[model samples]
Each structure stands twice: as structure tokens, then as C-alpha cells.
Target: MPKKRVQVVLNEDIRKLGNNGDLVEVAPGYARNYLIPQHKAVFATPGVLKQVERRRQAEQRRLEAQRQEAIAFKDSLETIHRFRIERQVGEGEAIFGTVTNQDVAEAIQEQTGREVDRRGISLPDEINKIGFYKAHVKLHSDITAEIEIQVAPS
Candidate 1:
């Protein structure tokens, strides 16, 4: 017999299934053995579907607001010509410590009043010297901006 399939409403995001409040189809065995017991999903009954729909609407509105904020932040980020980081200098223009992605994220937050995850910042290379460099930041999945970073001797 063909494997049985069941429809479920997701209560939380599942990497393979779908996002929270999404209606998805999966094997009955998987749904019953894991999803239902774990409370990650529920059978797609009429009532459950209605509830999921309401949650989806709320999630959509929140996501839209976040996207707008990200866009505005991107605009502001583009306007920034450079960011300077002061570090102790040694011989041959070498910095005592490296300028890391976490440092870049903190600098952006301090300068722009917006928080950025360190993982979202990409450095062209390891910053071991006092010089100007370009750093790319992913504000959102679809929005990216580049900023100039100047490492200066303190």
C-alpha cells in the first residue's frame, strides 16, 4: 500500500516541514510518532486550520514591519562612508589584536543605533593591520550593505 499521508498545522518552524502556522502534508507515521507527541503540529481539522490562519495573519504583519525597518536601516547604512576602530598599534602598522566580525557588528550598532548579528558581517580578510577595509553586512536575507572600516592606531 502507498504510504499514508496526513495534513497538519505546524505550531513551530520545522526545517524540512515548513514555517510556524503553516499547513503541511507528511507521512502519517512521522506525524503520529513525532509531530503530534512532540506538539510541533496538530491534525488539520477545520478548527485547527482556522487557528493557524489567524496566527499566520499576525506573523505576516510582524514580518512586514520588520522588513520595512530593515529597508530603512539599509538606507542609513549606505550613507555611512566609513567606520573607524581604534586599536593598540605595534611595529609595522600591525594591531595588537585583530578586528573581528563581532567587533564590526558592535561598531555598526554603536554608530547606527541598530543591532546586527556578528554572523551577518563578512570581512574581506583577517584584519591584523591598521588600515581601511570593506565589510559587508546582511541586514536581512534579501538586503545587504557594504561599509568602509578603518582600523587606526589608538
Candidate 2:
């Protein structure tokens, strides 16, 4: 029988994950030749296993700091700017057409000077009605943003 050790980088935040971190079980050859060499992480030796505690703590602190900063930045933005869109409407108050990500990107660019990706700017599955809406901007895997959109007669 053969036994080996390996370390896994937490793709998601580690705070929620238990202290027993997810260690990618792999052949020692692959762990040494590929994963560890790539800096993906280290082999779970006694010393490295000891680091999980510190590393998790450090990651948690960093995540919290980043979250706080994002909140503060979002608050500041709320006071100064909001992303808005304009569209043509029909007599019945229904939007004549639709609003796509490009429209939202351009609106954000024009309003806030922030170049957001259309893919990153998510609209309703189908935004055909004339009204205000909210779009989620995936700032990070763990962080997201919402922007106010105003649809009016174009």
C-alpha cells in the first residue's frame, strides 16, 4: 500500500469551510511534479498542515477587509452616481423593444466612467417592460454589485 499528502487551495473563501480543509487527494508524483510546482499549493506535510490554520485566518481577515472596503466604496458611489438607461416606450407604457448589456455598459460608462463588461452586467432574463430595474455586477466570485437602471421613452 502507498500513501501520499497534498494541499488544496480553497477556491472559495475559507471561513465557511471547516478547519479540516479540502486537500486534493492525488498521487504523490502528480502532487510533487505538477500541483506543488505550480504553486497551486504544497504537499500536506506536518509543517504545511500546520499552516492551514494561519492561512485560513489570514484569508478570512483579507476577505473581511476587502468586503468592508467594497461596502464603503459602494456607499460612496451611491451618493455620487447611479447607472441609468433610457429606452423607447409604447402608448401602453410597455417598452417598445429591449435593453441589452451593451446599453447598460454604455450607461455605466457615461454615468460613472467605469467600463463594465456586458457579460458582467446581468439584466433581467428579458427586460421588455418600461420601468426601472436592477442589474447585478459580478465584481468577484464572492462579491457582486447592483446598479439602478431607469427605462423611459427614448
Candidate 3:
């Protein structure tokens, strides 16, 4: 006689098996004695599969909506285009302090009335002099905006 296998839906990730919400086949003994008793998985039934499918669809829809919102924000930031920062100068055009991401974020907030995370802003190089520079702001994982930065002597 051969051992029987049963189908079950994983409640969470199981090593060398499958991830949460996945339907996988395992030994009947393991499913009945261990996985089911431990609340790690449930027998794969028609109703359970349907419920899991619904949850997956809902999650996909929510993520798509969030991505769309991020796209709109990126467009708005691009429209504004430029941000200016006034820094104290020492000699020539060299500024006394370096231009940091925090400064750029504040500039955006002051100009557009929108709060941006400083950690998401990337400066190309050191902005220690009065000049025009470019900055890349990551609004989302897939969306980025380029802004012109004008550094001037205060």
C-alpha cells in the first residue's frame, strides 16, 4: 500500500513547502496530526480556495490604487520643476555649509505646500557652491521626479 497525500492551504510559510495562502499536497498523516492541530494549515476545500482568491484580488486592487496615486504625485512634483535654497556664502560662490536632502525637502514643502520625505531625495553631488543642480526624488518604487535646484547666496 502507498501513503496517501492530502491537499491543504498554508496559513503561513512552511520551509521547503509553500507560502501562506498556497495550496500544496502533503502526507495525510502530517496534515491531520501536525499541520491542522498546530493551526499551520487547513484542508483545501472549495470555500477556502474561493476565500483566498478573493483576498488576493482585493490586495492587488489596493496596490494598484496606491501606485496610481504615486504616479499623480510624481506628475505634480515634476510640474513644479524647480526649488531654490538660499545658503550663507563665505568666499567666491562657495557656500559655508553643504546642501543636504533635508534642505531640499523643506524647499519643496515651502514652495508647493506638500511634505516630502528627505530620505527619498537623491542629490547628484556636493552642493557647496552657488549654482544650478539636479535632484532625483523617489515618490514611489517605480516613479521618480527630477527637480532643478538653484543654490544662491543668502
Candidate 4:
């Protein structure tokens, strides 16, 4: 006998299946046992599908607004020459301590009036000297921007 399949609306994003408010087909057993029990999905009846459409529309609007904000932030970063971070300098031009991702994120937030997650900042190498370095900011999945960071003695 052919495996039973059912259509449902996802309440949350699932890696391989679909995103929240998406209509998807899955095995009946999986949908009833896992998705329904976990409150991750609901049967795609006409009424529920209408609700899902509304939710999807709202989510799209929110995402679009975020993308626009991200684009403006990227433009601001591109216009900036360098972001200065002050640290104690040891003998020679070496910094007393390493500059971490959190340091970079904080500096960006201070200068740009925007908050960036430390995980979104990509460092090419360990910054252990009082000098200049480039850090890549992942603003969105499809958008990235590079910023010049200057480490100077306090």
C-alpha cells in the first residue's frame, strides 16, 4: 500500500520542509505524531490556510523592512573610513590583549547606532597588534559589508 500523506501548515521553520506559515506535505504518521503533537504544524483546512496566508504576508512585510534597514546600515559602513578601537599598547606596536569579535561588534554599534551580533562579525585573523584590520559584517544572508578597524594605543 502507498504511504499516507497529509498537507499541513507549518507553525515554525523546519530545515528541509518549509518555513513558518508555509503549506507543506508530509507523511501522515510524521505529521500526527511529531508535528501536531509538538505544536509545530496544523492540518491545512480552508480556514487554517487562510490564517496561514495572513501570517505569511505579515512575516514578509517584517522581513522586507529588516532588509531595507540592513541595506542602509551597509551603506553607512561603506562610507566610514575607519572605526577606531583604543587599547593598551605593549612594547613595540603590539596590543596588550587580543581584539575579539565582541569588541568589534560593540565598536560598530557605538559608531553606527545599530547593534550587530558578535557571531555576524567575521575576522580574517587574530588581531594582536595596534594597527589596521578589516572585518566583514554579515548583515543578511545575501548582504555583506567590510569595515576598516584601526587599533590605536590608549
Compare the candidates by TM-score and give the number of the best one: 3
Best by lDDT: 3
RMSD of each: 3.6, 6.6, 2.4, 3.3
Q: Looking at candidate 1, what is the lDDT of residue 19?
A: 91
Q: What are the clashing pairs of model 4?
A: none
Candidate 2's displacement at residue 149, Å, is 1.1
What are the clashing pairs of model 1? none
lDDT of 2: 0.67
Which of candidates 2 and 4 is the stronger one according to TM-score?
Answer: 4
lDDT of 1 by residue, 37-95 (tens): 99999999999888877877898899989888888888898898688889999999999
**Ranked candidates (TM-score, high to low):** 3, 4, 1, 2
lDDT of 3 by residue, 32-71 (tens): 9999999999999999999989988999899999889878
RMSD score of candidate 3 (Å):
2.4
Model 4 agreement with the true structure over 29-80: per-residue lDDT tens digits: 9998999999999999999988877877898899999899889889998898
Q: Could you give me the TM-score of model 4 versus the true structure?
A: 0.76
Of the two candidates 2 and 4, the one with more favorable lDDT, higher being better, is 4
Q: Write the per-residue lDDT of candidate 2 for residues 1-154, one digit (tens) a residue.
A: 6686445543232344323455556566865786567655555667665676788799899988878876764554455445667777777787866888898878766766766568877887877877778777665456667777778776
- Tell me the whole-model lDDT of each prediction, alpha carbons only: 0.89, 0.67, 0.92, 0.89
lDDT against true structure, model 3? 0.92
Weakest ten-residue segment in model 3 by summed lDDT: 69-78
**Candidate 4 RMSD computed on C-alpha atoms after optimal superposition onto the true structure:** 3.3
Model 1 weakest lDDT span, ten residues long: 48-57
Better of 2 and 3 by lDDT: 3
